[model samples]
Target: MNHLRVSGLRKRYGEQEVVAGIDLELRPGECFGLLGPNGAGKTTTLRLCLGLIDPDGGEIEVLGLPVPARAREARRRTGVVPQADNLDPDFTVEENLLVYGRYFGLRQAEARARIPALLEFAGLSARAASRIQTLSGGMKRRLTLARALINDPDLIFLDEPTTGLDPQARHLIWERLRQLLNQGKTVFLTTHFMDEAERLAHRLAIMDRGRIIAHGAPRELIAKHIEPQVVEVYGDGAGRWAREFGQAHSERCEQTGETIFCYTHDADSLVHHLDQRSGLRYLHRPANLEDVFLKLTGRELRD
Candidate 1:
């Protein structure tokens, strides 16, 4: 059975319809990503699935159980790493895991037994007695991830799991997530980083203005929505060059600031011209998920 299924899901706030007629399904052991901008209702959808709030319309089934009614029951088998760390300040690293494990109704002995492994999994074995305040940003994030696994859930929800993390920290988290997938765990992820979505999501959905506009395997979506090749020229003369070259050669073109992005089926002419221009900084590469995202969602900044 699918880990999660939502059909015709809808949610509203005052006059605004945040989630509109959404449909989604997650196969077991799949890392499904949900992408969207602020006010896109991504969080609301997560809440609806979790039964943290009731939907205005539609059906949601999590772990084969009907939601809102069995949301609590479904939650027991699902883990969550929220966008913000909620670890208690007073608790030690070990204490935090123990306390969270207790919420799952684990016996003292069982929780204790899991603590050592959980600490080690989080790379905090040496810091077991460390207070939450003493940990760095990355360490805290890892601890939160570890705490979510206190119950050894079958499904995990990670909301912007690497938001404030540095490159090193982000890579570590990615490695850990990979390990969980190897163990056959289903990961439901929400993130704004295109690279992260491309790397981790087996399948993904993109949302805007409270609805899913596009979704598929990263490469599939990229191939379907954008040109295969892209030439990004950025410098003082970029906008002018884009205006001229885009009219004659590119399938599509966009100019932001002093940078010009030319999307085309073939970039040979563009690259040849760029190479002739001295001191012109340009990148020629294959299209990626971000290209598809921008094409479908537009380049306007969301508030």
Candidate 2:
């Protein structure tokens, strides 16, 4: 059975529609990702699913229960790690977990009994007595994740869970999330980091301007919308290269920043064409999620 279902979802702020219309489904044990630039309505969609705000139109079901009407019951089976770490500075590492568990109706004794295991799982067993303010950014993130799991939820929502962190810290969080998946927990996440979504999501939907532009497995989307290989030409005369190559292969060329990218399955033909031109140094590589994002959504800044 699908763990979550959303159909024709719509939300608006006054007369301005932020989420025009959207639909998605997530099966058990699947890691589904929502990718988009800022103001693309990713957060608004999450809020609608969580029943934090009522959607102007459409439906949302979590674990077979309709949201808001059954939000309380649905919440009991759900966990969330918001974009920001909202840990209480006054509480100790263990204290935070205990406090959050209370919201799920866990008794003090029951919450206490779960503390040691939860701390160990979050990698905070060694810092159980430390105040929240004393933890490092990575530690705080882990604690937030642990707090979400205190209720032993079946499904979890992670919103930009590792936005600002070192590579090591990010990898640690990824490993932990993978462990959760191994235990059959479903995860729904939103991220701007292409690598994060590429590495973790089983399938994803890319949103733009409050609508889904593309949806599928990362590899599938790349294959369907972009060439397997891309040749990136840089340095001086990049624009000339883009113009010349774009005219020769109008369907396969894109210019961004100081580079001209040529996307094609026949890399050798493009390479032969470039060899005749001077000041046209390039790199040939496989296309990734970023390439697909750029192809579907033009290189325009969105706030």
1-303 per-residue lDDT for model 1 (tens digits)? 999999999999999999988999999999999998878888889889899999999999999999999998999999999998999898899999998988889998999998888888899999999999999999999999999999999989999999999999999999999999999999999998899999999999999988899999998999889999999998988877777765478888888778788999999999998898876799999999888888888888999
**Best candidate per TM-score, number?**
1
On residues 77-178, what C-alpha lDDT tens digit does candidate 2 reach at each position? Answer: 999999989998888999899999999999999999988988998898999999988899999999999999999889999999999988999999999999
Compared with the true structure, all predictions reach lDDT values of 0.91, 0.90
For model 1, the stretches where C-alpha displacement exceeds 4 angstroms are: none
Per-model TM-score versus the true fold: 0.98, 0.95
What C-alpha lDDT, on a 0 to 100 scale, does residue 152 get in candidate 1? Answer: 95
Q: Where does the lowest 10-residue lDDT sum fall in candidate 2? A: 242-251
TM-score of candidate 2 versus the correct structure, residues matched by position: 0.95
